[model samples]
Target chain A: MITIVAKSIVKEGKLETFKALAQEMVEKSRKEKGCITYQLYQDIHNDHVMTFIEEWEDMESVEAHQKTEHFEKNVPKMKALRHPSSEMTLYKKYI
Target chain B: MITIVAKSIVKEGKLETFKALAQEMVEKSRKEKGCITYQLYQDIHNDHVMTFIEEWEDMESVEAHQKTEHFEKNVPKMKALRHPSSEMTLYKKYI
Candidate 1:
């Protein structure tokens, strides 16, 4: 299995904008064939920090996700609202 | 459940130190009462990027972890090995 954790800092004052986009992204991602789970979370202490937890069937599906229309389309727009900084990590499940 | 994904940039050349600390942390965490899973992953593309994904029974267990001796002992040392900068997120599991 493959897991991805994406963290981003939303530009101040754009919290609602980010959430709306995330809602769309999560809904679409959860319906994909290889997607096991897709979840969104925000820090209780820091609203600006948001994260996405994803589990996929394998690395191939994860790579394919990067090319999906939902990802390519919303990501650019979401990036615009971010703090010019973000990070992504891919993991091959290791218990 | 409370899930935590911790991302940290190891100080240059401190990969071994980080791994040793992580190994200790994961082993100890998995034995704790509420811990369901504790995992560590390194970026396939960048060795400097490392992440820890943890699942717990509840927020209380996660909060308790912060005060655990293993945590208090290793975290400071790990922090010292980290790039002066890093990030941590606490996720209330939502799918």
Candidate 2:
């Protein structure tokens, strides 16, 4: 499986909207084939920092997720809510 | 539960040592009363970049984890294997 850690620093006052949109994305993502897990998290020390830890069956699945209507539509909206310099990393299980 | 995403950039040639030490830490951590999950991953695009996605029952469990013999002994070793800008972030489930 492939794991993705997506981090973003939200623009001030956009957290609630971001969360709502993210929830919709997550719900849709969960229904996709090859989605093992799709969940959102908020930084405990910094409320403005949000994260999504996702697991997919493989690279094809990830690509499929990116092409979904929900993803294509909402990801830009989500990005608009974030500050510059936010990051994402994809990892392979090593242990 | 509380989640922690710990990222580290391993020093060149130290990935094996870091992984071995991390495995020891994960095994010990999993036995802790409040540890829900403790697993390691390596960035697929950058092999030297490692991450630990951990889950604990609460803040107290996390504190207790830091004080354990395995943690106290191995964390520094892991740090010594890492580059200077490695980061750790704690998160609370928001979805």
Candidate 3:
């Protein structure tokens, strides 16, 4: 499985809109094939920081996910409201 | 559930040792009560970065986990081998 840890810092005054977009993306992403889990999380210590923890069956599935309409539409919108320090890291299970 | 995303940058020359210590912690943490998941993952884009993704039943369960023997023994040792940018974030499910 491949896991994605997307940590985003929402821009000031855009929390609500950012969340709405994220929730919509999450709901749609969960329905895609090979999706093991896809969920949104808020940092307990930093309210402006949101995380998307996603588990896909394989790299092929993840590639397919990028081509989906929801991804194409929402991701750019989300990025426009994000600050520069945000990070997206791909991970492979270890140990 | 409470999820912890621990992203640590291993010190130079400590990758193998860090992995060994992390694997031992994963093995023990998995046996703790209320531990839904305890895993180690290597960053696909950066060899120096390792992440520990942990899920527990609730706040109480997470508190209990901090007091476990494995935690007491290994965490500090692991920390010593970590670089300065390491972060540990607690998250609450938002959707």
Best candidate (score: lDDT) = 2
Interface RMSD of 3: 0.8
* Residues forming the 10-long window of minimal summed lDDT in candidate 3 chain B: B39-48
lDDT of 1 by residue, A1-95 (tens): 87888888899899898889998999999988899999998776677888898899998888888889999999999989888678677876533
Ranking, lDDT, top scorer first: 2, 3, 1
Better of 1 and 3 by TM-score: 3
Worst 10 residues of 1 chain B by lDDT: B86-95
Give candidate 1 regions above 4 Å deviation: B93-95
Q: Give the range of the ten consecutive residues with the poorest summed lDDT in model 3 chain A.
A: A86-95
Indicate whether candidate 2 or candidate 3 has the larger DockQ.
3
lDDT for model 3, on a 0 to 1 scale? 0.93
Query: How good is model 3 by TM-score?
Result: 0.95
User: Clashes per prediction?
Assistant: 0, 0, 0
For residues B8-75, write the lDDT of model 3, one tens digit per residue: 99999998898888998999889989999998899888888999999999989999989988889888
> Candidates' TM-scores?
0.86, 0.96, 0.95
Model 2 segments beyond 4 Å from truth? none
* DockQ-derived CAPRI band for the predicted complex in model 1: medium
